[model samples]
Target: MKMWLPVVLVSLLLGGLPATHATAGTRSCNNNGIVVLHGMPLVTVDHKCVQILCLNGLPMPKLFENANSGCCEFKNTLYAPGQVFLDGCVKMTCEKSKWKPVGNTEFRCKRCEVFNDPHFMSFDRHRFDYHGECTYALTQEQFSRTPNFGIFTEFKKCYAVPSCLHRTIFKDNPKLLIGIGYLGLNAPKIYDILINGEKFTIPGDNYAHRLIVKEEDQDVLVWRQGSCIRILGSNGLTLQQCTNSIDIWAHPDLKNKVNGLCGSPDDNIDNDFTSRGKQVFDVEGFAPQEFAESWLTPPGCPAGRKKGSAKKNFGNDKMK
Candidate 1:
């Protein structure tokens, strides 16, 4: 009798089938100290901005190249639309096809004894309007240290202080399953999804497609999907895939379809899906139930911690 065991094993290995112990390694990621996906950053696409969700965490990807260059990781995401960096310093929005400055776009210096003091984006409506609705601000003391601080009226300071929270979600499952709701710019056109440097195209009409992957040797990070990029998560609960209602409105027939894959389009800028909400993709279910009950709720980051006092904003006029 011929022993065919060795031959069978060799065939299986050469055939490239999934083995029992997958060699793909895994990594642990703390998104705002909350674990959503194990390795990659949580990126959400919207017409207005391609947000890099947890911009506060450490060991940040070469996204910004030291956070001083005013650049973020993933070119199409952060510096897309207008090719301008939205590092919290410039008050600009992605309009039509370019990064237009909403109000103030220049860095205003604050007189600070040490460039490491805590500063935040000012929210004074009058001041915002005065300063062209800029989101960056600093203390008068900090402003003093600013070069050319108070040198020009165009270079103004903010009165109302703003607040930032490390919005996060914790899940036990290390696997990540993303459901792309829509693609294209004007209409729900077909676009390609870049996963771990590989591109996969899903038809525009099909919103139920999913990019499923667990931590492994396969680098399964979504770089680009259609018109949006540099996508961080949302401040509200629901992660908006498009800039406004138009994207959802464009597809009346696919309303339910889009909702199933990426939540309701109306729930874009607002609404939180922390407790319970529609799955990003209907094909896949929610994260495991083992996630911490408290952690699953809204407000992912801890309270009483300074949110915006990072290395990017502590130096001369550097704010993002």
Candidate 2:
């Protein structure tokens, strides 16, 4: 039998009238101005296929399953669980009580993260660490095709550590370039940003077709959510620069179509160690230091020592 909680709790919250003095033969319940005889069912006005039972001088609501029951409501329409519908380009499913996306909804992008000790998580969810301190391409379109874009990061010795992320650059092919530079160890909260080689202040204006730059508390956010960048397709991209970490995300259109230290997100972790020179390294082998070195920015920049190197002075010389 279908069971339900007593409606007395709900009635109390709605400021229900106090229970009338009960005699042996006059036991009944009044709900929404209707007198319900004991053990009789009353259908509520708001819900379908559910009934309220007057029992013991109180109203108890219960849900019953029928041909029209166990369905979800959306805009006054009922849909069976697991029913799929489309709202524009997005496909949604009614799951018993709520609506959920079916697949590849907006904001469903692949993520690549660079965090403490400069560890890396690729777009395909492969995790690795590369401690080389040099500017490197974090991710970019395959073969640097036109309408291409690239996210790069420069690692430097900071707080005496050999490799710490100190700068991030997002280049949208031929024209737009955004650079985010972190202040030195003593004053890490301050940031120096540059747009197309000119100094850019915080809370900057949104570039219509490119990206929006905003400062939130201590971190700076650069994103293209609704605005479509050709390389990222519709879902767009987002980059968050925190104190010592950088987080990046690219739309699903970039899957299997990108190459860098972030790897090609083809859903296969085996080839995630592909080097800048198009060489694939064995995932089970030793750390691919050469793969990391090949992505060094400027084509000929010197590589920084691994994590075990002697601590440096962390002065202006190390910031480059």
Candidate 3:
């Protein structure tokens, strides 16, 4: 259930509503009655999505953009340039104060509260205790927040990390962990052949329930769904001899779902992915329930303290 959030986000980002393209030098914030904003999704005024005031969901307009000038945003066109907020807090302030960084990159500024919850502003019907949420110590060592868009890279680059790459290639944010591939003994020969733009060769032999690899990106170029995984014999991609479901593709498969306290990213998700790990996907990969209990636990302490292995351990001695 938690894994489905990333799927919802993908659909929103890719399926952003169509808006009029702006002309050179002049960006019509009020483009023919439609409000648009920079770095935000298009929210039609008077749309059912909003309920507070008759003003409707405020559209964050992209004020200016160019190869030279990246992009600038105006907050509802209300506060002018002179007006400022207390650093780290969004409330208005006459003096400059400390500024809080949001997420992994130095993209957007946030209030002390939004600093706690990136997904909190989605504010819709779903609201959680962002201030109380705690990130894994490992993540805190490597990144500021969930290495999300606007924060990392010039834009959102690491968003498409592979399953193996999670907690490995990136900042080891457990929230990004999505189990892929199961070690199946009798699990047939190849259940799914996940890939990006790059094509990989699978060995001809027994079957596999899932395909898992460690990489940094998964910008899918194309997929051959409704096809079966077959032995790469002299015939090349022979579908007739395909024996496994992972090999014999009847249904369309997507990508793994992201799980975390922050808002789900805007991207496509393949529901086939689950958080259950290999037990469900690869029967052979199953371990004793007792062993699985302490799977997420670390053997040592965090990076802050010198030799305080007994100092702090997440999920173990949090309250103490």
Candidate 4:
């Protein structure tokens, strides 16, 4: 069953009525006439300048007006800024805040849409929707909070992401160890890298320090060595080495290796991009649940450790 709270409570939160019952704001207008606030044309037998109060279920102006100046009675609906509601396919949103009700001013609400494309994944009420085709994360953070707008209706915030030029690959099972295409010098400045279920953030400023991918060079291998992952460049040059879930994407080619937590990166499958990697929009058919357990593991030991230890190992890392 649909339930609703009393409007008086809403008014309290809105700070609509005065705290005390003082007749200071009221004065005698028409002699033998009802008493009311000085300028307002409300007719009341009691000389109370107190603002008229009404609850949600009560009807309009007559609730607070006397028979004499009942024509002056007008009801208003209050709304706060950033609140969103839907009026069918078009959405309505309050652009500003209004605590107390005023007369005749129309409430202006902007209109919006729920879906920009049908091919995109379905919108999840609780979580953000990823628009792989446009690389936007549609969020419900901006939905309206106005009373009666809707508990379910949500306005969206389309967040732009960096380029998704790489593809995806998998080891024996695509669920647990998912692979991103090989990384190159021209990789996106910002993107998502998920290992298991953990995410790694690579910002624009540290792109040069965090990534080193040779264009068209398949000799270098990027793989998950058990709990630790590493990027093996030419001449056995270790571009990057860490044991935690690695968060970065690259092309589909190069090679992939999976080793144990204490195992070397060299022992694993060499899965390269057999063809062009799938784009974001094309992934709707592939369910996200197919991925195995996504755990939040700490990063593997530091890269370039001496004798495969978590010691400083990037002695020859050129800051390209």
Candidate 5:
């Protein structure tokens, strides 16, 4: 008998899929390193900006095509609303993990990822991710150098910063789309796609990257990790498929879904530095096991939190 294998795809729509009750936020992220996804710098977060999760101590994928860790690799059962990058998604549930938090969107628990994962989205399609890493402060800098956003120090030296983590790919071929990271914007701007170098923004929304990739290769790394060129191939390269970034769903719901929050990693700016009844790390100090379906957003916002009305005042921008 002859064996027949079908070609896989590497594309994500980033929207319109069943929500996993997945809620991601961070009362504080360390002001240190950076992580690069789809050519964008995911700068180290302040203690009050947002949260990010990664799996460490695991084997790296040999080829870009094999970089898929799946959902089981997330360290500890860190699944919960307001929790950044909840783990253990496979054969997992909000009720079983007691992940869902009160007043939080069900999608927090329901979603695997609006986008692909360096941990959960494995490069080794056949292998399951065993370890993970959540980047903070200086550690994030290992990924890249250039950042769309930047700041000046008291000494007047210029510094780069990470504000968003986004990437895109094509739906048909792996060589078409590419990932682009935006550091800081002069003002709120919308997202659009460029077909053959043509600019095409989403019809109703401008959350972030559109997340377009090949369905068959969706499990692999269609796009590279650091650079944001169209994932499409050129030269001896595929000539135009796309890079891997968002999950297969990132596209279908691209126009309606929230693309996480966007904020400046400016340490000089004022952020919720203290808490009333709780200490600063109390939010991060909570254990996943201690979390329950009922436990939701901490009692109140952190102290010195940026103004809720004028986000830009504190050098913050909440991207919904």
Candidate 6:
């Protein structure tokens, strides 16, 4: 019975029961109350940007310098380092856990106005008059850049006058087009507003992609402000149309980057007579008639019979 007892005990230990031995060559890590095996991916908890991973039999934690925790916050969204965004007309970028201005932070806007009898005021503040009946480029990015845009004005006879701004077109690159038309100079109200060839209503907060339309008294305003340019890829175009005039505002970033009737916007009025063919006429010898004819939209529109010299109020100061 004793011999049988010994054999039975050995048999039970070898086969009848599971072996009681420590696991070999196996590693794991304990994170709080959770168990993680070796070779597992990094794990994050409670939205903490810091991550932990199991290496060998121990847990290792690492902090990422450029992680979401270090990103810039704008309007409840996170922006990675070096990501650029627009705050109103100001350009900003994310860096070192903060939002910083990308270039010049100053908010500078240049104004160009076309008023009564269609007097022209360039962005550099050089004023002139062109009495031609044809479509002409008001302002354009002569050197193509991203989000290329331009404005065109159509002149027609109004109240027997040879030239009056009958319609204005704001073209955004290859897709978006906005037009504001007037019946006549004396017409008390605007005839209509067009978006991509379709009649559109004013005061539209949401229309034509990212454009915001609103009515300010007698003027119809179209603009893109704040972070709206994230989708439009532009600082934004501000167009204000009234009964007898049109005002176009350009962002400071566009300084020295545009041409056409608005002329070069380098803060130099002497070069305001830049022609469509890239020829700059001397302000002293400036021939307003020839300069106006060079900007005819179709290259060969009918010449205005009532030709006159532009006000030579700008002196003989050479372009600097």
lDDT of candidates 1 onward, in order: 0.24, 0.53, 0.20, 0.22, 0.20, 0.53
Scored against the true structure, residue 177 in model 3 reaches a CA lDDT of 27
| lDDT of candidate 5 over 1-320, digit per residue (tens) | 00111112111111211122112242222213322222121111211122222213111112123222221112222223233332211122223212221232223222211111221111111111111111111101111222111110000011232111222223223244332222211111213344435554333321111233432112111222122221211111111111222222211112222111111122211211112122222212321111111111211123432211111121232211
Q: How much lDDT does candidate 1 score?
A: 0.24
Q: Which digits, one per residue and each the tens of the lDDT, describe model 3 over residues 1-320?
A: 00112323433532332233322233323334654433233421111111111112222322212111211112212122223322211122111111111222111221111111111221111222111111121111112233331111000112231101111112112322221122121223233332322234443323211222353222111112223232111101111111111111110110122222211222322211112232221112322232112112232223432220110112221110
TM-score, one value per model? 0.18, 0.51, 0.16, 0.15, 0.18, 0.53
Q: Model 6: number of clashes?
A: 0
lDDT of 6 by residue, 218-258 (tens): 11123222211111224344555665677666776777777
Residue 13's lDDT in candidate 2: 26
Q: Determine which window of 10 residues in candidate 5 has minimal summed lDDT.
A: 148-157
Per-residue accuracy of model 1 over 200-292 as CA lDDT, tens digit each: 564433112223343221112222224432112111111113221111111122222221111222323221111123222111233222211
lDDT of 5: 0.20
Candidate 2 residue-wise lDDT at 1: 16
Question: What is the full ranking by lDDT, best candidate first?
Answer: 2, 6, 1, 4, 3, 5
Residue 305 miss distance in model 5 (angstroms):
34
Q: Per-residue error at 83 for model 3, in Å?
A: 1.9
lDDT of 4: 0.22
Q: Is 2 or 4 the stronger prediction by lDDT?
A: 2
Candidate 4, RMSD to the unseen true structure: 26.1
Model 2 collision count: 0
